[model samples]
Target: MTENRRFLLRRRPDGDPVRDDFELVSAPVPSPPPGGFVMRNHYCSIDPAMRGWMDDEPSYMPPIALDDPVRATTVGVVHASDNDDYAVGQWVMGLNAIEEYSVVTPGHFTAPVDVEAVDSPTRFLTAMGAVSLTAYFGMTDVAKPKAGETLCVTGAAGAVGSVVGQIGKIHGCRVIGIAGGAEKCRRLTEDYSFDVAIDYRGKDIEELRAEIAQAAPDGLDMVFENVGSPIMEAEVFNLATHARIVLCGLISEYNAEERVGLRNLWQLIVHQATIHGFLIADYAPRFPEGGAKIMEWVREGKLRIDEDVQEGIENSYDTFMRLFSGANEGKQILKLP
Candidate 1:
């Protein structure tokens, strides 16, 4: 534990990231500087957004620099502290890196989390974490689901999309989830209570659009989009008048060498719909407000969040690839030994 192991970004990726794109290195355990603290990371969050961050492009956050540990959100405990406000052994979660240890300062992304307030520290990366907050604000504030209206969710089986569909149901909206494979589609209805589940696997854009049209014959009043491009284009073909589209994430294009542009944007103009880009960082100040409400639903058995936990730093690459491969069942996490 004395040596800090880090998964460093060796180079920027061209298409899908390869193992050579990152290098695992061991360095001396770092000590906290003035007004800072050192945290021993227990779990690293594996999200699709990490792929986007690796590319040298404009984004909400800076691209991961070459030779630096890949940026990620981690839940851990204070191993050492130089800050008066943070004490050793306190549980915290923050936008850190894929390393055994992290030097942290109290700021927008680094803060103490109450372990007693939740079931487990890993839950901070799932249910009561940024994933849930993204779903909450996207539905409650942006899309604004209304009773009896149809809500179409792309990537509906994912961490954010699953929560979004459930939130839609809570508001009395009919939920239609579009996911890959039969199992994921089944889970949309049986597990998440989505009214209809459309399997987009092995289907062309028109084929997928036809299914969406059948599932939501009245046209979709709201769309919670996670996977972009073709899936989003398919959703657009079935929009109701004044439909709202929440652009949460575009996992499909994140790893593409060349990003795909939508051909169905004219549907938005025809329907007089609106598409709003959403970033969770913009809602940092209201995290407590959203987290509390999500926790309330979770405690009351109205919400369910799943986690796919893998062990060891060596498995980080494969674990992370699950986000793009559709192999992960829920919120992908890499647990540090």
Candidate 2:
């Protein structure tokens, strides 16, 4: 029997999660039945969404059970296969626990991965995985951004934020990104080709509003909000009439014990702005179509995908906490043994 090292939730997190909240333990890998396959995990994705999963609240996805292996998306190599569809030595992406190995019976959870075509295994966690798909559908299908319109994205240096801003550009919108620091702001504008980038760190609400106004003088036609709390409040005051705000992840409020109140909600009614909260799982059926278009843009050099890869699985807790602190420059993933 194969022995695997796995990270399990020792306790549900309050505020930001710490390494002690997770317990790394060894487990005997279960033998795959007739239809199952055994996989050796190579990399695991660490996303902001995982924080939401820790809460025992109603969400787009089910919360992870306490003491269970932490739920995550992973890229792995098939080591033993009883399922003809998944051959040994082939790479695959699946919703597996953070483990050295896993046994899975494929259904809604597993898909083949072409690692070479993707540039890196981590891309499956970022551009080609749920992150890119969220941006693709949220902007294209939900927000319906048009050319010449002004699009603003928050958490703009993150995995989903970067892709959302780029997709806005592809749709011919003047794209502006809101990031946390000078370095992230510089990368958003210089590397990702955002029309403007705002650094929100140390800035008061007035300063933030002023920078946003300067960047989008006519108001924002579309807003892809990844950070919530105070930033969302500021954006509300600057929304254009009939503006569509796609509410994706709320990184800001994740650390709060209680939900932060948005003081400017009346702005939504006054400006006729529509705020829609979405999870990528809702667009599961259309993933291929969206994924194909994103890949095409990537291949044509119209979209740039970025990733901040932590070197080892042992550092997963630190890497995950980086999302809330804005320490990660791109999609955060951990390379496993």
* Residue 119's lDDT in candidate 2: 71
Weakest 10 consecutive residues of candidate 2 by summed lDDT: 311-320
The lDDT of each candidate is 0.92, 0.86
The top-ranked prediction according to lDDT is: 1
The TM-score leader among the candidates is 1
* lDDT of each residue in 32-121, candidate 1, tens digit only: 989999999999999999998898889888999999998999999999999988899999899999999999988989878999988788
Q: What would the per-residue lDDT of candidate 2 be over residues 1-337, giving only the tens digit for each residue? A: 3677888898888887888899888888766678989888888888888888888999777999988878889998998889998999999999987878888889786899888887777777877799999999998889998889999999999889899999998888999999887899899988899999888889888888888888888899899999986877778788999999999978888879888778889999989999898888878778778878888999999999988888766776787788777788778888886
Residue-pair clashes per candidate: 0, 0
Model 2 regions lying over 4 Å from their true place: none
